[model samples]
Target: MNQTTAGVADDLDPDIRRFQREMAAAYGRYPDFDRLPLTERRRIAEEVRAPWAAGGPVMHSTETLNVGPFGVRIRIHRPDARQVLPALIYVHGGGWTLFSLDTHDRLMREYAARAGVAVVGIDYSLSPEAKFPRALDEIVSVVRWLRSEGAAHGLDPQRIAIGGDSAGGNLSVAANLALLRDGDAPLSAILVNYGAFDRESVYPSYERYDGPEYNLTTAEMAVFWANYLRGAQDFSDPLASPMRAEVAGLPPTFFAVAACDVLADENRAMADRLRAAGVPVMLREYAGATHSFLEAVSISPLADRAFAEASTWLAAQISANNDNDSQ
Candidate 1:
């Protein structure tokens, strides 16, 4: 491990340490997703992450919506069917090439049931296959589709929020920006979780967690970007890197940062930029958390607390948005 990572290793949460060992054992080594064949890498990742994805079958109903070209697979997790409710367009994070609706099903269900809003989990096409703006394009299409046809799915189009974790958080913000840029109505709010916002950013956490000690390495991040972007040209595109995008018109936002994550500083910078631009932003840093800790919500108390905080905050923002519209 690097010296900076070693220094911070002792301060990591006990559960995080246990998770790293557990994950290492399952994968036979730390995952180098960029080096492995796509199918093999996905299989190992899914198997290794399976244990932490624990949750009983969700009580809320679920259904799939097929949007063409983008083939944006919309998996809606509804809290109930008694009335129309606010909804969130949830994008899952796997560096834009891993994970699916099933991987994030429980997390989405927990948020849906807890927040009393429908969660539309997006299973968009992955990168190297779809590339940078393709996924972002699908996000835009999905958000717009949600706005136009949400009522048919028991969702209140005017009360929809957008959110995602890791790369998904990047897309969530980017999609909202795209919508506003296109002169569409604004989304209710945004939920970002440990997102990778800047493809070209260099932060302290990158060095501190540059090796396998923290489960995610800067080298792996580099691979992820290369695979997700068309080429070097895409790096500076504000849609691909939201930190460089205009932020003045963003909706109220709540994003979480893992104290030990490489992306922590980048996420912080995004929050700071948003707040500086007069956008309402709430940034939460969990003391002992690591990247993708939310995936362990079933097994980690820290993860659970993070989810609860996000859930409460999301419900409030969506509720406030609804109240404002009524007024």
Candidate 2:
């Protein structure tokens, strides 16, 4: 059954449909969005997403710092004035090209407030200009810095987790892999939300949810990959496409899969692979959700439910990690 031909929009969860409509209307203002240059496109995208990032659970304190040789900027959102706290190092999803810490401000704050941990959002270098491994290197460096120097910022080095959505998800896992290769897997947890795991392979979900109705299309993914990769060979590089990498010995992982997303199948496959590798895996599929659905937390109860569930799971993972560290 080719659901695309049947108009998949008709099958969208009502709240999700509303989100799509609102987002579409916002992007509709820029009729020449696709034809614009990368700089212009990104500027417009920031403007479009400003409304959604407007309001959320305010943090007890927020600080920005430039760390590492590359001066990677990270925004730390602490939920309360704790002398020491566990942290979730969050990477924002923008296909490795768009979005930033500012665009995902609310999302980070929500996690910090709900999960009772500091949310550290890294402003990694974006694609086409930065290329593969550049962002990955910066992320790994930031993790190391947090471990060695984070106490000054009130972060517990041994109780840190890393996570992100879409391309950010891909980097979160790749960073851990980089650490493992260096004989260090210090992260307590990994959170993947509809991540782009495999770049070289096409899955069944692409056919069913690749249309514009889903907010993420196959064509757009192709462009994002091209922008992020330096050459064709990079597609098979495990760090660039984690589905091709070794998954065993990683820490506990939580996957927030969107049932209607083009990346849904890959998220599931990654979860299964992790479980097979004997890693503690928590896979939760959000029914009737689409790509980038979590950004609708301001309006959609489905998005709210998904966040609440992920936060609960994240809190437990960090808490358990804390208890183990005490032992």
Candidate 3:
């Protein structure tokens, strides 16, 4: 709580401060993941870290569709009218095992309503249930399904984007790579918010922030990947860890990183790789923030502001692409 660095000092956004305190109280009992058994940790994630639905935009309706091998449940957030708006496929972050569409309901609704686009939240199969490649496969299939049937939902098929936070961000990048690798439908843009893009080696942040109540930690990350990979030693595979992928010609991207999150370095590294590959990219690092900030809409004003910034960036890209094509 460095007042000078964070600005506002004691005048911290009331909502944000309250949310942080609530989170601290919630996880106070279970401070260290290492102490808890795997089952207990999972239980805490599901039962304790559940996100509160916030007030902002209203969703017209929720439609569930089973389109993947595991009967993947996808939630669609439709806008008020039946206009052909751009659509963003959102994936929630929980280290690929905990959070789902239910935890991110408010964030998705805000994205759809504020971005003025249809949002499809993908409930991809989780680890120890479907594992790494399985979840990746489900996400890829959902994107393909959208490309085939998006027009029916008043969505412009060509204006589809894919994005998510943390593990979901990893999947967003993986799904796009799968599309390109298989010569399937290509996404127009990719949005990765504080994505955990590297798992093979722990970065500097991991060493610096491995404590509890900070939201995500380096030690917790090791546990996540242990469950996520399950001894499948292909961490360097570009699809699983997009940081290692050849970014030479991937789609345009928007990367949002939190200042204090352990995953901050890897997300920034991925952004640099994308830029090196000549891809059009917008990279933003929010100061004085932690991982998974975007989903905790009730607690983080920075999260809401971050989402709005992402929407603006996405709109600009869509508009820019549209203009380029018309020329």
Full-model lDDT for every candidate = 0.80, 0.88, 0.74
> Residue by residue across 20-129, what tens digits does model 3's lDDT show?
56666666666575476756766765655555654657777668877655677888887667567778899888888777787777778887877777888988777866
How high is each candidate's TM-score?
0.92, 0.96, 0.87
RMSD of 1: 3.0
**What's the TM for model 2?**
0.96
C-alpha lDDT of residue 21 in model 3: 60
Q: Any residue pairs clashing in model 1, and if so which?
A: none
Model 1 Cα lDDT, one tens digit per residue, 183-205: 97668889999998898747988
TM-score of 1: 0.92
| Candidate 3 segments whose C-alpha is farther than 4 A from its true place | 1-18, 29-44, 47-51, 68-70, 230-232, 319-327
Q: Which candidate is the best by TM-score?
A: 2
- Model 1 residue 71 distance off true place after TM-score fit, in angstroms: 3.5
The positional error of residue 238 in candidate 2, measured at the CA in angstroms, is 0.6
- The RMSD of every model to the true structure, in order and in angstroms, is 3.0, 2.9, 4.3
